[model samples]
Target: MEPMIWRQAEQALAGLLAARFTKDIIRKAEERMRADVHGTLPRWISAWQRLPQTGSLDLEATRQTSAVVVSNAEPIDLEPLTRLLMEFHPWRKGPFEIFGTRIDTEWRSDWKWNRMAEKLEFRGKKILDVGCGNGYYGWKMLAEGADFVLGCDPFLLYVMQFEVFRKYAPQPHRHFVLPLGDTDLPDRMQCFDLCLSMGVLYHRSGPIDHLQKMHGTLKPGGQLLLETLVIESDQPAVLVPKGRYAKMRNVWFIPSVAMLEIWLERTGFEDIRILDVSTTTEEEQRRTPWMTFESLADFLDPQDPRKTVEGYPAPRRAMLLAVARK
Candidate 1:
């Protein structure tokens, strides 16, 4: 079936007085929409018209068919989608805005927010900001009373951003440092009370391998606060052909929720929890209409707990924020 928003638009267009119009004009409009356009507007119109009165559309049931093939399309830039969500519907303060990025309302709706606050409030806790882009979260932790906060990133560009933050918002114990990768950390192994490993796992060729190294830096019983894109289904998966990862060779895989759970277990982590999050918006849905490889716009809805694209049927999208004890 077509998107509800587009269907409503089509219905509004159909109901308009057409005495000033002729059959030829309508035919030409349909022709233009269908002939070599990025999306098939005519087909969408037909689906929209049929949607209301149909016996049983059963979109959820239709998703499980054996013939379904996951779409391999690249996501259009997510910034527009994020911006759209931020503008129209505000995600309340629990998870709230990370700098400008939209995320879940509460970072941990299941876990005690006060417990997290306590961890952040620890008077002399050492913190490591892994892939700490601009150290936004790092600075927040520092302000919350962490005794020491060290932000690390492989990218020199981001390291420079951290430097800028240090110069303007200097803190006695908070410092930003650069590490090229696992091998570059200082000789004495330092343990941290909390590790912010957000938005870094999906961009790697071997996520766990890097994660294990990150885990090595933490003290026993240290907490790893992780956030990354994740798949939702139980079935084992395959990478999309010619997918976005192809554009960036270092991009490896996005793990499923279950896979991540197992990885944490194998790596000796305990008390793991998965948080469902969406990072897309309505205006974003409008600006980049071609992002759907197989009618995937629906998966972008923040309210829906399940993450899967339309037509393709696989659980292709979601944000996973998990915390595990080391």
Candidate 2:
């Protein structure tokens, strides 16, 4: 069989990203796709090949709905379809409905989109989404009238999950999720109209450097929507967890909202606004059938919901909007 990985993404990037960056990005992505040694890849690929093709579904209807719903005019057997989708388990970032089967993901990512969608406009904009899990928000952005969306996530499983959707969507070329992260992006490309770095900052050891890289990728006056875990403090304070916070081993710096603003300013971003800061709730993130792994509820102290099992303040996230200053 012909290569199924990164083929459409490579084609889409040819027209979307700058020529200076396109070749290098595609080259590296292709290399990663080829070098995969994961044992589950073959099983995932087999499952992808068996998915029933729905010819020309109404893509417009998805724009008005919350879920990425794809339906055929005629009913098809859902039992096998659901099982095929289950092959790529642990859906982290969406609540997608393929045919009639609802894949209730770990995160109610739609809730996050609803919070930020009113403040922003996506009409005809070129967007770059860093750490885009399963490209869930990319579809939401497309629904909001984005010209094109290029998303990158280092996790190959998320990339495969995206492929499941891309396999059935009518216009697959408009959105893509490459198996790469922010660091893999070309240097000083300065091409996108909007850059999104949501739920990714605290994972980076150098949060400031990550912000600077995001700043460099956008055109002058381009907008950036950054969301990350923040500690509540009147003063500029940050928690550098000596060990796991909320049962997550990768978390590094959980800064105050005030400190996050300073990081954006120092990284050449202006018009900084803290759009929303909300504590994560079990209703928003929990163990679901689609995602059977431990969730936010498991990470918190059963005795005290306010504190994590490690005694740090529980996961409180903040959304910030700013513009790249040349």
Candidate 3:
């Protein structure tokens, strides 16, 4: 399969990369994608491309539920579309609607969007989303009136998920989902007007370095929106889970909101604001038809909802907004 992001590099980035700094960022992004394809990636790409080419794809995306509706189509072939989409299983982020097929993902995702949307203004901004699963929020960002959105995630399935939507959506050039992560980002490129890292901080073994990378990606005075799992506490504290938090083996540092503020200050981010802090609910994340797997419900302790099955504090997320220091 041809590289999924090549067309975006050629078409969408025409005038956007006139600046030398941004051009190099794009160049490194391309190199990373080329170097990373492996395992079931080729199969996933083929399945995505094989999806029926339908016309009259009126792409109406919304901030509510992160749903992208493809209406006014010429009799969408749902059976084959379902078959092809299922090839890339375990859909985590979106709750997208393609030709009336509601992909009820594992995470309602829109719940998080609703909490953060009021605090953020995406209009006319060049945005970068770290760990952007399936570009769901990227679409929401576009709907919020973003000029351009670039999402980077190491997950190949999520990249394929974006391709499935792009095949039918109009003005897809405005959004591009790259197969990369926070560590892979170009150092201090200072390209984007806004940089967002959601549900990613805990996964990083090196939280301080992750903060630095996020800080480096932003232009001076650019806004950085961070959402992460945090432990509730009075004093400054961080939970380095001995084994796993919520059955997720890779989770490392989950800090209190107070600790996070200090970390952001230390990392050279200014004007920090804590937007919202809410514990994730079962309604917000549960096993769905589209993502039929163990979910937040499975991760929680049966006796007490506030604790995980592993007995850690149940997932509580915090949305933080900060300005990149000049």
TM-score of each: 0.50, 0.96, 0.92
lDDT of 2 by residue, 167-275 (tens): 7666656887877888998878788999999999999998998999999889999999999999999888999998999989999999999899899999999999989
Q: Can you give the lDDT of residue 217 in candidate 3?
A: 82
What lDDT score belongs to each candidate, Candidate 1 first? 0.44, 0.86, 0.83
Worst 10 residues of 3 by lDDT: 56-65
- What TM-score does candidate 3 reach? 0.92
Give the clashing residue pairs of candidate 3, or none.
Answer: none
Candidate 3 structure quality by residue, lDDT tens digits, 32-105: 55535466776786796687667433434454445766554467778888888889788888788877778888
Ranking by TM-score: 2, 3, 1
**lDDT (10s digit) by residue, model 1, range 285-310:** 22222122322243433445243322
**Model 2, TM vs. native:** 0.96
Candidate 2 error regions (>4 Å): 1-7, 55-58
User: What lDDT is reached at residue 88 by model 3?
Assistant: 77
**Quick one: how many clashes does candidate 2 have?**
0
Top model number, TM-score: 2
